[model samples]
Target: MRLMRKSRRARFWMSVVVAFVILSFLLSIVSYVWAAVDEVFVLSIDGAIDPAVASYIERGFKEAESVGARAVLLEINTPGGAVDSALRIRNRMDESPLQTIVLVKHSALSAGSLIALAGDVLVMRPGSTIGAAEPRWVIPGSEPRPVDAKTLSAWKAEMEGTASAHGRDARIAAGMVDVDMEIEGVKSRGELLTLTAEQARELGMCDAVQGTRQQALKFCGLGSCSQNEVNMGAAEHMARVMTNPLVAGLFLMVGIALLVIEFFTLGWGIPGTLGLICIGLFFGGHLVAGLAGWESVVLFLLGVVLLLLEILVVPGFGIPGIAGLVALGVSVFLAVGSVEQALITLAIAGVGAVLLVILALRFIEKRNYWPRFILMDRQSSQEGYTSRETGYDRYVGQQGEALTVLRPSGTALIDGERLDVVSEGDFVEPGQKVRIVKVEGLRIVVRPEK
Candidate 1:
């Protein structure tokens, strides 16, 4: 009977041990699942989708991965921008391990549509719209124009593929890019398809329609997740502003215009400094955006050096000047990256620079500011100021000492008047005694004296 009691006690202890082990395992599983679904990273992509936007998205993904986030929610609001930039953002989304939930808070037109469709789950806020994914040449101050038929066909395929990758309808995606494409009861020929949030849901393009961002997250099963909002840094903001074709063109225009004004009027001052700042902003922003590299900057600096050599050191504009101009053009062209974009920017800068220079010159002239910048005081005979030529004939036979080294031309102290003189066919060292041989108008010819 005692043996039987011992056996029961042992079995009771074993049962307790097994229950404890099972409880620990269940707790660990719960903790792991909770940790896995707790954190969500949010990124806001607003304004035009430029290189800066692409860079920000890429960095955001890296940060999310490092923090072990399970999903990323992108709040998108844009009128579209560079196709290359949009593609870069799309490719990044595809490569990331985390799930992408795109929330179109506002209009995601054109290239924005391409990116919106690349997400694993798409949600549109109430009243938000998407589509108009047509490829166009977006020139500032000009209407967007459609691309060539070949480009249209290629872009159409890309749009369709991106949408189809996530199980969205290829026809709807194609309809956004191809105006000729028709979706029965959705879009007619000759019209690009743009859909409201309700329309997007009904057409199966959007997974859910939510009134608020939190609701959208809840719809995606991330409602209880801790939010980490990633905002654009200063460098990215600067890049976005500087990379705009119109703004970049303006900076170039202002830089060149101000420098030209400063060159013609003052030696160097406010205008020149401001001009340098403008140019620096242009290069700095482009450098940050990855549009311009160190090579382009070095080329630009070399161009400036050559130009300065031509102006200050070289006697006239020749190879250095021409080469400098070419280098400047090439660097700008390379920085802009696109031929059409470069041409447009260059043309705008050229025309705007001319206008700015004209206006600045007029303002300077009207304000009588030339006296401050230039030697405006004139010495005339009426002021008892005699021309150097007036007494040059008197010094024809006078002996003088060379005041400056003469490579055919120099200054001489003839009778202590410091006359301008030219050597007779030979170089003359300073402090050498010389005699004036002839006077032709203002020209005083001199030779080394015995």
Candidate 2:
């Protein structure tokens, strides 16, 4: 009976150990699932939606997917940017496996409005505004104007489609792009549809109106999730600065102006170096933003080479010079990514460069530095600076023989000396006798001997 009791006790302990092991295994699985589903990736778009911004959002979505995040929280506070870039961001949002909870922190106008409606759940902060997405044709030097009819139609349709896809009112979206569109009491006949946070929520455009990011997260059911804020890196920031229209135009203008001044001045100097740096920044920034590529750089370099050939090697502005100008224009156009923008930039830069060159030349001339840059000393007759032989008049009646055939000009041996002579509208052949008729400056006129 003692042995049986001991054996029973041993079996009971073994059963307890097995139950504990099973419970521990189940707990680990539950903990892992909870951790996996509670992760949220947060991204922010606080500026214009350029290529860099689009790339940032794309990377954010990729990282969220990689970490098994349940959703992404995108904070938007922007006026607008390139429509193409906004479309790219929207496409990325649509393709992301993770749900996107967009939080409009301040303003979402123009292209920003398009990207805002791409999220699964959109929440707007209090006092924030959305809409005013009417597409504008904005050239750098000109005032903003309405886009063409085709562009307006297409953009309106795109906005409406995006809204309809998310079960929002499409008419409101259309009103954002088309000023003529009216939604009764929502917007006037000739005005765009810009809604406050409260109005957006009331109109069903916003899923919720949250005052803070935390509240927005709670509205999206990710309040308990661990948030990882993904910030823009140095490269992206630089890209944004370089791709800005004002900055880009300034860089181009300064670069061209400095380079033109350098060309007018003497050898290579600080102006040329600074000019190159400015131009380099312009292209490099566009490259980082994905608006320019290796092809554009290569083309620009080729253009520079051709231009140098025109200035240094070629005697006149012919094919190389014209081709160089065209190549340079094309390279800048490609870098700028828009025809009207590029044209305005080039025009402004060209005019600015001409004016700067004139001013620089005037300053250099006043400083008596003209002799260093150009041949300012002229060989004038009054100054006793003659390019002709002084005693050439002594041989005016001298006889000579033509050394080479000439239609109007040839070399002749006159008075046992070689002289470059010109016939008075007569053809003279080699080994023919001739007479010197006149001597004018460097000219020695000769006639065939009879």
Candidate 3:
């Protein structure tokens, strides 16, 4: 009985140990699953808010939404970008179903502030500033001019609508974009008040003035929210490369030069192919960046076609050429975001075209003159007749009258025999009297016979 009792006790202890081990294993799996399910996504916007940033944000939000992200944090630190691009990003944000939060870790000025206002919630760090959302025209060699009243009104409506949807004060947001605006008591006598974090809070411009992402997440009832960063992809990288000003300028130069060469040589071969490709790339990149619309592309293509016709079909540069040049200039100006950029691009393209033309002319002149100067013997044919015993020997010293204008080569009657002759030095009129000086290899050299 004693041995049986001891065996029972040992069996009971073994069962307890097995139960404890299974419970610990189950807890480990549960903890891992919970941690995996509670991750939050973070996307950074650290540069100017260009088309690339818009694309990145749109794609990131779509991806996060697909994965059922708890929240998406946009860490914004930008000055601004093209107005069109900012508007596009704002529209995307307003339509997105994901919980979007804009965390102004640093300054979000100009268009950047407009984008931030589009977010569902706005969070700002200590000492972080916002609200310089006015639109200004950037002109070369001059101070930026404020947008006109109509443009300002449109921008105000856009900002106000976006702010109102997010539970922020629309009037205050509108004031941020218009310099002449003054919120009733916010400004002193003749003093314009740019709202700080505290002022924004009092004016209902921002949701909260937080110090860190953790505090932001906690306030949103996501205390255990994890962070994930969305990085640039291959497409984004390619977009950036194509948008570079140096690259765009290089493409413009190569395209124009190739087209010019095609016009002059070989009647459209490899040069034409390369020219079309480069021009296509230039316009395609601008189109994707939202800087160029379909209208600009059509104008550009029409200009190219007109220019081609002027160079290849027309007798000389005239109305067609001038019109084509004007159209091309307008197209190029519309392709760039700002007038300053357009002018700079035009200057570079013009300089490049001049340089290329000079080089091509030199090349053609060298090809024409090099053989006559250095390789004269090799150029002469062995089977060609000479003046010593040629049938044209009787034509020497014969008086003739040029039938065609003789700049260098013309038609002249030599002893009643119509012959192809070259003027000696002076340009001879069509009816000018000429004397045959030499005849070699069917070439009749003539001189003006006083």
Candidate 4:
């Protein structure tokens, strides 16, 4: 009986030990898996670089840092973009905490190339080309002119500073900006060279020529590193699309159409409200996108003022209206990237306005021909027509004295009956005797009795 009890106690102790060991092993596995699942955030930059792209990149960096990402890989494939926007993006990248690696999948010419040099590490594909970043202006009707010496020098300094920050050959980076630059022991005699992946590695411009992201990760001492794709959601994607210049231009056209319809209808209602909202959204998007500055806003306001003058003070759509449109067009062009986009927007707005005007005119004509345009329980009395209760049977021939200065519209007293009247083309001073010349549509037309 003593041996049986001792055996039972030993079996219980052994089972406890085995269970503890299994639990410890399972915890170790979970910890290992957690460590291995560390992520690297990716930011893909394709096509022309702009404020939209810059914003996207900046936002991506913030998110990566928030999630404790291991690193950020900026996959670059751009022709170029606005210089100011590029500089802003470069400055942001320089200030970022996470390690930034620019992966040149196909190419990184011009502004794209500048962005790559700003990265902590640059990875390129074997057959990819990079460089030719000289600044040139695309003047209308002429070939692109090389930027002036002063501009070139400033840009070269900026490029060199950015390159040196990332432990790159600053001189080579500067050469990319000034095509006339030549560095000794770097390029063959008189050879205008754009760096290929192999040449970039030889010149220490790129760390490695990798065929795929996996290879890039391995080469960067992250052989076991895992990755998570950082992507924009559906709402973010739609926001980005609406912020585009083309989409904003379309909105402007729709707004103009609504405004034209409201103008012809002679009342402020649904069309006017929709027009105001659309225009507000159009300007708001541009403002948020950083494409439009305060200058554009000021110009747009000035144009509005001029257009009001054309409508109220002037008789025809002459100088004021034309000038207003011109100012508005110039403002819009300056707010966008290029002249082509501006012209496209103008064409669309014009077509939409014409169609809206035609529709409005037809509606007005139909209303004039058809009675009961607006359903009403009672018909309103006509203006300038005397009611039978007034006892003014002989008022049409009786003279009246102007009670107030009739600079187009004021009050008059005829036979002790006060009346609101408007002068026809001439000013009528107070105390002047006036005659009721005509009566039409609630307006009493009066003139000075000669």
Residue runs of model 2 more than 4 Å from their true location after superposition: 1-37, 264-267, 369-450
Q: How well does model 2 score by local distance difference test?
A: 0.87
Candidate 4, residue 147: the lDDT equals 74
Overall local distance difference test of candidate 1: 0.89
Q: Candidate 4 residues 369-442, lDDT tens each?
A: 32323333443475444444533444666689999777778789988989887888688888999998776546
| lDDT per model vs. reference | 0.89, 0.87, 0.77, 0.76
Worst 10 residues of 3 by lDDT: 370-379
Q: How well does each candidate superpose onto the true structure, as a TM-score?
A: 0.75, 0.74, 0.64, 0.64
Tens-digit lDDT track of model 3 for 1-450: 999999999999999999999999999988866764586778877877766667777788888777677678888888776676688888888887777888888888888888888888888887777777888876434687877889888988988898888888887777778777776776533333356677677777778899998898887777787788898677565555555555677788878887877666644577779988988888777776656788888998888888888765663467889999899889988887666677767776778877986796688677784343233454345667333455887788889899877767768887767787888767888898999888875778999988
Candidate 3 wrongly placed segments (more than 4 Å): 1-39, 140-142, 188-193, 234-251, 258-281, 287-306, 317-352, 355-450
Highest TM-score model number: 1
Worst 10 residues of 4 by lDDT: 369-378
Candidate 2: tens digits of C-alpha lDDT, residues 1-450: 999999999999999999999999999988877876998899999978888888788888888888678899999999998898999899889888888899999999999998889889999999999999999877765688888899999989889999999889899999988988778889889988899999999999999998998898887778898989998888878888887777777788889788877777668988899999999998988887778887887898898899989777664467899999999899988997888768876777767777877887788878987787666777788998767567799998989899976567768899889987889978888899999989877889999998
Off by over 4 Å in 4: 1-37, 136-153, 180-193, 239-247, 266-277, 280-284, 287-436, 446-450
lDDT winner: 1
Minimum summed lDDT over a 10-residue window in model 1 is located at 309-318
What alpha-carbon RMSD in Å does predicted model 4 have with respect to the real structure? 8.5
